[model samples]
Target: MVKLNKKYLKPLKNFYVIGLITFVIWMLFFDAHSWLLHNDLNKDIEALEDEKKYYKNEMKKDKKAIRELSTDEGVEKVARETYYMKKHDEEIYIIEYEDSLLKSKKDE
Candidate 1:
């Protein structure tokens, strides 16, 4: 048989205090909407917010590029740099160093 000492049972004698303790325990662990669940949800919200911020920054950069590309000079510069394009009279020579060549393959 288990014994309930007077010191231990004193707080349990208060119905309101016992209820408050039980409610706290249940809310923290056992409820469908629990403290742990809320914590995980809050973490997910933070990650999504960070991702949203990153995408917003990328969109701003793209918008700036679009504005620049509105000019013929910008269009030719982007084409020459990105697509390795050249005027009919110009010769394009791509020089790849050994260090740059050995920078690990992409399809791992």
Candidate 2:
């Protein structure tokens, strides 16, 4: 019985040490505040990834616009609408929607 007890003591002490270390690590690094911080970081990463995807899509649209604007017809269309300029003897018409003209009316 004495020899058996001695044989188990070393293993028991090792397990105790390991358990204590694990507890300390869990308390310091895996507690509620740590978990909340990790979750926040994950959410922030997801939001940034969404922002990146949005910007990538926007970049694609802008690139398409740039390519189109390289053509003469696209340039003329943008200039005519944006600057309200037309060729000689060309008449420009302004169209306004009654619904959009009043912001409060549209909300109701």
Candidate 3:
């Protein structure tokens, strides 16, 4: 059975080879912080960074809009469009196009 033993145990004959294999296995699976975990954490960090950038950009846009809306004319425009506010005795009629009505029916 020497031939069978030699075939299975040939790599263990070299101390450096055995040490390298052990180190690789330990780093990949047995360590507290494995290579796979590090890779996944890195991806998570990248995704969080992208989300941070998106939120920063959105915050900047919101700040600009807030600054604009602080003015009287900007407030009036937003009030008229969003709340449909009108002066006393003013009449407001909402008109929807045929295509928009068809689109709304299709959506429903």
Candidate 4:
């Protein structure tokens, strides 16, 4: 009887240890909260990367405008296009978008 008990106890102990290790691993790496946090981190990383790209593009456009405005012609061109500034004899016309008209209709 003693020999039979000893034979079974070793395998049972080993199985318990293996099961505990697997459970610990699952809780750390594959559990619901762990998965949620991992997914959130991925989305945060993607959003930050998109923000970085947007800022890079804005900086590039700003730098190009700066370089152009360092000369007389670029500043004049930007002012005319953006602010409707013109030479003494020139005229300006402003065009409004249809969305603003629709928005006013909805509000009333």
List the global CA lDDT of all models.
0.92, 0.88, 0.93, 0.88
Which residue pairs collide in model 3, if any?
none
Better of 1 and 2 by lDDT: 1
Q: What would the per-residue lDDT of candidate 2 be over residues 62-90, giving only the tens digit for each residue?
A: 99999989999999999898999899989
Per-candidate TM vs. native?
0.74, 0.62, 0.79, 0.52
TM-score of 2: 0.62
Which candidate do you rate higher for TM-score, 2 or 3? 3
Candidate 3 per-residue lDDT over residues 1-108, each given as its tens digit: 999999989889999999999999999987979999999999999999999999999999999989979999999888888899988999888889999999999999
Q: Write the per-residue lDDT of candidate 1 for residues 1-83, one digit (tens) a residue.
A: 13557778888899999999999999999999999999999999999999999999999999999998999999999999999
The candidate scoring highest on lDDT is 3
Off by over 4 Å in 4: 1-18, 21-33, 89-108
- Please identify which of the two predictions, 1 or 3, would achieve the higher lDDT against the true structure: 3
Q: For this target, which candidate reaches the highest TM-score against the unseen true structure?
A: 3
Off by over 4 Å in 3: 1-9
The TM-score-based order of candidates, best leading, equals 3, 1, 2, 4
